[model samples]
Target: MNPQERPSWRQQSPEVQQQVRQDSEHFRKCLDYLREHSAGEHEGFYGPDSMTWVIYREPVILLGGLRAILLQIAHPAVAIGVAQNSNFRGDLLGRARRTYTAMYQLVFGGLPEAMGAAKRVHSLHSRVNGALPAGAGPQGEGRYRANDPLLQRWVLATLIDGAMEVFETFVRPLSTEEKRRFYEESRLAAAQFGLLPEQMPPTLEAFYAWYHEQLAGDALRVGDTARELAGLLFNSPFTRGQLDELLTAGLLPQRWREAYGLAWGLGQQRAWRLLKGTMRRAINLTPPTLRCVTAWHQAQMRLAQARGARPTVMARVLNTLDSYVDVPFSIRPVAAKTPAADRD
Candidate 1:
């Protein structure tokens, strides 16, 4: 079945507009649920003890950034939305920095901050809607809204899968229980994006079945728009891109590698294996403070201060650096909001 062939988001249609209102209402409820259940003084959706923090705090997750984006755009609707709405070609690093910052805020910031970040992203996504171009495969006539639940689900899946791949490859493998816990936490995060529980797989094993089917199926087509976006990411007038291309190509699903026309032979495979081994060794030797990202350190500092404990010297230093990068330190309480159509 062609996923993209599903009915498009039509703004003028009363049905679609009603669906949008329903989605907004659902998202607000999800936010309330999170605030009631997961929001502590300093803990966001997933606290410091969560498997999310364990896997995501590692700096190696950065290696998965491109992999996630590549997998996201493999869906034709996503590629079209990105191609139409993004300024990635003109401001790649700035775009990437903002994206990473928002992700960090969602994962590591205080409850209010995480909610604010989620609202901001949802608002921006509310504006991204367009039809696929001609010769865009079988779903050329389909329209897309970034807020579409299925599209959001696919994007979320890519992020989770990419992070899991990088963490397992360059750090250590997780047990089934560990992975299951992580997947459960991810569902909570997914709720922030307006996805209903019924829309997602109920368990980790079920998710893998769905994810593997996506990887192996023709549902993912790397079209012209996707290729253009990939070129912008992989061949910009940025840093030397050899290592970036190597890692992205090596880490992408084998089917997607072929779809994207990335060459992967014995030499590349051997090199990838050697690099993975070296990274695993290096990460094993590194101390946690050095191996973790600044956002993790900032979260630790925030929590420490809330408990009236002095943060470590390294935590203070990293907190200062994180500030320079515009990482959010706090969020004010949520105010009474207007309607989504008006506010967004």
Candidate 2:
């Protein structure tokens, strides 16, 4: 049978449909709880908007869990290669390399904000540190130092990996034109950050500046879409003015309006699901105040076993791993720590 003709949840067997309904109901309850409880102040860099709330609530936990699985199942060489080719070696290569490394660790290690809402972030942070080459890891133990090369790489890696996950897991296969458009947009955004194809910056400051700029552009695009949607809703033949007013008043947040760009582009539903999944994994792997990348990794292994992967998904994911490892970066086995020699 053609893959497109395969039965979806709605067309499943009666028992399977019942299970899906139960799961959907559970998910709705979870979402409602998230909407209610995530209102107060946040302890991170982002604020108390719906997007931020969704991010901190369940999605982070889910994404963290996914990251844990990816780390465990994926070969170490794949991680290292992704870290290397992510940026170009150039003037200030040391700083550029460090910034990318930090990005990777932040995403892979899962560092938490200072506000103390999520402690698992730090657990993954420490695990990645332990995994890093000696003299290369998070600086000062808690905060991501601007000067730390390893930390820089971790940060970059996280962004790239997170974005890629959304692309692969959620976005349906795109046409060649769609793929070109997406890359074109990404490239244009990257260029605005002073990231030339051959001259990528090698420091945290440059990376952050560029990264934020890209996000800003994305926000603008999203904002435009939101406005168009609002106009459409308002001008709809069946939409009463009173109802529109109620929706505008109750549902729209100003921040979301301003930062409305969809990271998943036209695939809003899938993007939203992917984002929620990412957050959920992130949170589950490291609950507030706890530090344990190993636990997260173990959890992923269990989940994979439980899911009973089809040979095709397994093969594709493995191919991704192989492609990842082919990037030019060093990978070494985890080593046993030894005591330092005493000074004579």
* lDDT per model vs. reference: 0.78, 0.31
What TM-score does each of the candidates earn?
0.87, 0.21
Output the worst ten-in-a-row residue range by lDDT, candidate 2. Answer: 327-336
lDDT of 1 at 50: 95
Residue 117, candidate 2: how far off, in angstroms? 5.4
Residue pairs with clashing backbones, model 1: none
On residues 176-214, what C-alpha lDDT tens digit does candidate 1 reach at each position?
A: 899999998887778777776677899999999999998
Off by over 4 Å in 2: 1-44, 50-64, 67-114, 117-148, 167-344
Candidate 2 achieves a global lDDT of 0.31
Query: What value does the lDDT take at residue 149 in candidate 1?
Result: 81
What is the per-residue lDDT of model 2 for residues 57-150, given as tens digits with 9 covering 90 to 100?
2222223322322321122322332233222222233433343333222222211311121222222222221123332222323222121233
